[model samples]
Target: MKVIRAAVDEMWSVMGQMTSAVFRHGLPMTDKIAARTALTNFVLHIHPVRVRRSWIRMSYTLCLGGLSFFLFIVLTVTGLYLMFYYVPSTQHAYQDMRDLQFVVTFGGLIRNMHRWAAHAMVITVWLHMARVFLTGAYKKPREFNWGIGTLLLLITLLLSFTGYLLPWDQLSIWAVTVGTNMAKYAPIAGPYTRYLMLGGTAVGDATLLRFYVMHVVGLPLVGFLLMVVHFWRVRKDGFSGGL
Candidate 1:
């Protein structure tokens, strides 16, 4: 009976540790336990063990960074759904869009969500950067992260620009034409840049294919990698909002 009781106690002890590992929140019985939990738990490690209340105040930070990341997630999901039916060729791109709108179930809704989420992400990332600047969070050791953030913002804009032409509408063609034309004013590299972007002289099948590849694959991968570094830096440097 004593052996069985000992075995049961050991089982319960293992179970308790497992529970603690999974749910590390709430007040611990002691500071040692809290510190250990924060050190050992994956989720807890992502956040600082302690922070000043003002650092996380909604009014000061406005939750813009989180909102922007959330919008990015939404765009990724909806964009994937749209991709199943989308072909990047100029021949089928517009017709695919029309079919998505009129035939595919919830396609229109998904497309609109993707579009609006892209727009909102741009706004939120801009506001987040502005808040960081205004709060003096871009100074000192935090500057590298700030640069990463600026790159993120640029990537967001490029993603939007590249996606603007995928629908193959008249408006998209005109907009891209005007946008690419502006690339020709960059001194030595202007015309070459335009040609590189268009894959030739103008926005045609090659342009559509190039933009589509960048929009759906290349840019997002780079942005995601940057974001991982950004978050890591944020953790290491601590919250600048408190500064």
Candidate 2:
């Protein structure tokens, strides 16, 4: 379509501009022969050769945000595959879960990978936040990015909480019950919060549906938007520190 072509062309123009900027800064790039040689010799040939060693080290450690993003991609892939076999209902949910674990081919592996990736994302994001905090990366110019990161942390927690109910077992039931009960103590918004979350006074079909939608649709959408804001803010804030 014309729209698709226009979008692609626009993307190409932006990438071309970025490439020009990088080369104009005197970052290393060579002719075809040297490029091939570097590719053959180096472990990560994609990285610019002119970067300072200190920058490389800092990027690896502090860029756990990037790792968190990678894990999120993994989660999304595995989650999609798992969703093909999952039934987000009280009646068929537990059976589908058992089938995933014991019957479906590679289903258990996919589910396990998604679970572990989710946990890793949460841990990495928290560690990334801690690193930023200790480095005073949240100061002044970076405060908005810091706020975005905080929202991402909340989204991660919400993702985990929403996922806990998918198994549709006693554990899921009671865990959600206890979690929503805590929401009932949120000052003036507590009662309304629980009502909106559960769709009723009790955790049943409606509750599962709400949580499922939140996990698969609502929260991921917010996470993605916030992630864009976070990344753009980082670039705008000038890469955090001097190399």
Scored by lDDT, the top model is 1
Q: Determine which window of 10 residues in candidate 1 has minimal summed lDDT.
A: 19-28
Give every collision pair in model 1: none
Q: Write the per-residue lDDT of candidate 2 for residues 102-183, one digit (tens) a residue.
A: 9999999999998899899989999999988877878989988999999999999999899989989899989999999998
Clashing pairs in 2: none
TM-scores, all candidates, are 0.84, 0.78
Model 1, position 75, has a per-residue lDDT of 92
What is the C-alpha lDDT profile of model 1 across 1-243, one tens digit per residue? 999999999999999999877776557788777887787787667777777898899989899998998898999999999999999998899999999999999999999999999999999999999999899899998989999999999999999999999999999999999999999999999999999999999899999999999999999999999998999999888787664
TM-score of 1: 0.84
